[model samples]
Target: MASPHRSDDLHQGDPVEDPPASYEPVNSDDALPYDDYEAEHRPPPTLRLRLAPWDVISTALLLTLLVVLATATNWPWRLYGFLSDVCTGETCGLVPFGVDNYIYPVVWGGIGAAIAAAGVGPFVSLLKGWYMSFWPVLSLTILMVSSVVGDSLTLFSERYWH
Candidate 1:
C-alpha cells in the first residue's frame, strides 16, 4: 500500500521537521568577518581618462593613408567620371545629363562619411585594448579593390560600349 504522505508531497499544511540538534543556526543580523576585511582591502574600480597614444598615432597614419589613396585614385571624381561617360545622350536619357555634377558630390560625401564612421568604432576599440589590426587593413584593401574595380569598369565600357 502506498503511504498517505509521499516523500514528494509538499503541501502547505504538512508538519515541518525540526533541524538536528547538531545543526547550528546562523543569525541573519550577524555579518561575516571576512566581508568587512575584503571590502577594506579590495581596490576601488577607477575610471581612466588616458588615451592610448599608439592607437591614436596608428589611426592617424591610417587616415593619412586613406586620404592619399583617395587623392591618388580620385575615388569620388573617378566614380563621377565613370557615370558621366556611361550615361550619355538617348541611351540614358531618363536621368538628366550632367545631373551627376550636383549629385555625385553629395553621394560621395555620404559614402565617405559612412566609411569614416565605420572606422571610428574600430579605432575606439583599439584604444580600449581590443585587438583590431584588421580594420585598418580592411580599409586599405577596400580602397585598393575600389580603385581596381573603377579602372576595370572604365576599360570595359570604353572597349565594348564605345
Candidate 2:
C-alpha cells in the first residue's frame, strides 16, 4: 500500500530519487556494524605457526637444544629390549636366543615421536591437530632411520671424532 502522504513525483505524489552512479558490493565482513563488535578489546588473531603469539621464534631458537639431545655424546644411552615369547608371542625354544636390540631403538623413536606429538611441535601448531601437516611422526621415523643410517655415517664421520 502507498503511504497516505505519497506525492505525484514518486508516481503518486511521492518524492522521486536518483539511482546510484557507482555500485559497491556489500561484503559480509564489512556489512557487520563496526560498533557491534568489541574490536578494541578483541585479542589479536594468531596463525597456527605462532604457537603463543611470537613464541615460535623463541622455540625455533632453542631447537638446537632439542636436536642436540640426539647427538651421540649428548645421548649415548641406547634403549635396548628383548624379543621373548612373552613379549613378542613367538615360539622361542627351537631357536638360539638373540640379543634384545629393540628395546632402546624403538623406545628412543617413540620418545622423539611423543615430543613432536605432544611438545613444542604441537604447541607450535596452535595445539591444533592440523599441525600433523608438519609430519610430527617424522620425529620418530628419523630416529629409527638414523639408527640405521647413522651406523654408515659413523664409519666416515667418526674418523675425526674418535
Candidate 3:
C-alpha cells in the first residue's frame, strides 16, 4: 500500500536507477568525451626532453673539465708550466701572445657560453609554464657523477700512459 510519492521504495529489489537522459558526467574517469571521428585524428602523445639552465651549466662544466684533463694528461709539462706561473703571479695577467697564454681563458669562456646558451631555452619554457625543473637537475647530477668517474679514469690512465 504505497503512495505514488513512495513508489521508489517499492523498487528496492530492482537494480539502481539508470542516469537521467540529460545527465552528462563531463569529467568522469569512466567517460571519454572524444568521439570516433576526433579520436581517429588525434595525435599520439610524445615525450620531449628540453634542457634547462642547470643542465646546461653542468654539461659545460663537465666538458670544460674533460678538456682540461685531457690536455693536462697529454701534455703534463705545459700544464705544469702554466700552473706554476699562475700561482706566482698576482693574477694570470700574461699577454695573449700565443696559444699557450690564451687557451685556458678561452676554454673557460667557452664553458660559460655553453652554460648561458643552455639557460635560454629553459627560461622560455619557464615563462610559458612548460618547464620541469627536476629533469635538468637530475641530468646535472648524472653528468657530475660521470665526470668524476671520467676524471679518475683519466688520471689512472695518465699514470700508465706516461
Candidate 4:
C-alpha cells in the first residue's frame, strides 16, 4: 500500500485559493515617485579635480619640449628657404610661389599651439576650472605670440650670426 502523507498525494487534490479581501494589486498610481527614487539611488556629481603626479610632470615636459622646439630649432626657416628655392625654376609658374617671410612663423606657431593644446590643455583646464571649449582662443593667442617670437628670433639670428 502507498503512504498517505507522501508529497505527491498532498497536492494531488488541493484546490486553488483566492487572495484575501485586504490584498490589492500594485499599479503606477500606487508606486513611489520616480524622481525621489532616482534621487535616492543615483550617485552625486563630483566637483573635485584630481591630478596624478605623472600628469603634472608630463605636462611640464611637454611644455618644455614646445619651448625647446620653438627656440632651438631653425627648421621653420630651413623649410621656408627650401620652399622658396623650389619656386625659382622656370618649370614652375611665372608668378612666384615662394614662401613668404610671415608664413613659416605662423605655421610653426600654429603647429606649436596645436601640440600644446593636445598635450597640455587638460592640465590647464583642470587647474583653472575652465572647459576645453576655450582651446581655440587660447590656441590663437599662443599662435600670435609664438609667431612673433619665432620670427623675431629668426631675423635676429640671420642678421647677426649668419
User: Stretches of candidate 4 above 4 Å error?
Assistant: 1-33, 36-44, 79-81, 86-120, 124-162
- Candidate 1: give its CA RMSD in angstroms: 16.0
**lDDT for each residue of candidate 4 in 35-147, tens digit (9 for 90 to 100):** 66545544455566765666556556655664665579984465344333322224433322332344455656576766678557776778766554445445545655665
lDDT of 3 at 2: 18
In candidate 3, the residue pairs with backbone N, CA or C atoms under 3 Å apart (3 or more residues apart, or in different chains) clash, namely none
C-alpha lDDT values of all predictions: 0.52, 0.43, 0.44, 0.53
Each prediction's Cα RMSD?
16.0, 17.0, 17.8, 17.7
Q: Write the per-residue lDDT of candidate 3 for residues 10-126, one digit (tens) a residue.
A: 553455345677978867775544464345434455455565777556555755564565466753343323333332233323333332333344434443543444455356555
Residue ranges of candidate 2 with Cα displaced over 4 Å: 1-54, 78-109, 118-124, 127-162
Candidate 2 local Cα displacement, residue 144, angstroms: 16
- Regions of candidate 1 where Cα sits further than 4 Å from its true position: 1-52, 68-118, 123-129, 132-134
Give the range where candidate 1 is weakest over 10 consecutive residues by summed lDDT: 92-101
Q: How far off is residue 4 in model 4, in Å? A: 58
Judged by lDDT against the true structure, how good is candidate 2? 0.43
Tell me the lDDT of model 4 at 63: 58
Instruction: Provide the TM-score for each candidate, comma-separated.
Output: 0.39, 0.27, 0.24, 0.34
- Give me the displacement of residue 1 in model 2, in angstroms: 26
Model 1 over residues 1-162: C-alpha lDDT tens digits? 223433443443444355466956488455335456445534465554445667667767776776776678766575445545553445533333343233334445545644764477575664565644445666555544544554554445444344
Q: Please give the clash total of every predicted structure, in order.
A: 0, 11, 0, 0
TM-score: model 1 vs. ground truth: 0.39
Query: What stretches of model 3 exceed 4 Å from their correct place?
Result: 1-118, 135-139
Ranking by lDDT: 4, 1, 3, 2
